[model samples]
Target: MKIVRSKEFLGARAWDAQLIAAMQDATVRLHWTDQPYPWHVNDGQEVFAVLDGEVAMHYREHGRELVAHLGAGDIFYAAEGDAHSAHPLGQARILVIERAGSV
Candidate 1:
């Protein structure tokens, strides 16, 4: 068993991630980012969880842009074909689960 600490990700660069597990074509990771990510569509479904701090998630749905605020413990899910981006309110640590090799 491995003991992973999510807080360890705080203050790291945007998009920095720790691989927690991988099964088949799916992966679970812990990420740290204070910067905003570019909008992109997932090759597969995505599950995003806020572990520390706050985040403002931007997503495109039906050609409309939407924003969702995520605090610690909040969760966001994206189906395949969902285009989205995440902008941290400040520095934040998050957990992301998605298909391996997805950009």
Candidate 2:
């Protein structure tokens, strides 16, 4: 067994991650970033949970762009084909669960 620290976690670079689990087709990953990610559509569903700091989540729905300010403990669910992006406020750690190779 292993313990994973989610809060107050920091990494050297953006998108840095710790792989927690890998299944046949799905994986659970934790990441740290201080930059904004390019908007993209996920191949399948995605679960994003904030563990440290904050993230400005940007998403487009029906051609309309929206932004949500997410803090620690907030979760973002991205459905298949849902286009979205995340811009970290300073430094932040995120827990992600999605299809393997989806990054």
Candidate 3:
């Protein structure tokens, strides 16, 4: 058994992640970041959940740009082929579940 304290987790660099589990073709990760992630489309679906702090989720739909503010306990789902990026308001911890090897 493994126990993780989300509030106590930190990384050496921004966006560094702790691997929580690898289930078949998917992976569950805990990420800590104070910087924004670059925009990209994943090859499969993605589930992003905020565990601490806040984030500004920027996404594109219908060729338009949009953003959604996410706080603790909030979740953001990204379907395959959806272009998106994450910008933390300051520092944040997020739980991400996605297909293995996807980017």
Candidate 4:
């Protein structure tokens, strides 16, 4: 059994993550970041959940750019080949689940 105090988690660099678990072909990770992640499409589906703070989720749809404001407890789902990026308002902790070894 494992216990993680999400609020107590921190990383040395932006987007640094703590591996929470490896479930079959997917990986659950706790990430701490104050910076924006570059826009990219995942090889598989991705689930992004905000654990604390706020984030502005930027995504491209039909070649148009859009943004979704997200706060704590909000969840964002990205299907395969969906291009998106995340920009934290200040500092935020997020839980992400995606295929193992995905970028």
Show where candidate 3 strays beyond 4 Å: none
lDDT of 2 by residue, 31-87 (tens): 999899999999999999998889999999889999999999999999999999999
Where is model 1 poorest over a 10-residue stretch in terms of lDDT? 6-15
Model 1 spans with C-alpha error above 4 angstroms: 10-12
Q: Lowest-lDDT window of 10 residues in candidate 4?
A: 4-13
**lDDT tens readout by residue for model 3, 21-40:** 99999999999999999999
lDDT of 4 by residue, 10-92 (tens): 89999999999999999999999999999899999999999999999999999899999999999999999999999999999
Q: If both were scored by lDDT, which would come out higher, candidate 1 or candidate 2?
A: 2
C-alpha-based local distance difference test score of model 2: 0.91
Which stretches of model 2 miss by more than 4 angstroms? none
CA lDDT, candidate 4, residue 13 = 98
Q: What clash count does candidate 1 reach? A: 0
The candidate, 2 or 4, that scores higher on TM-score is 4
Clashing pairs in 1: none
Q: Say which prediction, candidate 1 or candidate 3, comes out ahead on TM-score.
A: 3
TM-score versus the correct structure, for each prediction = 0.93, 0.93, 0.98, 0.98
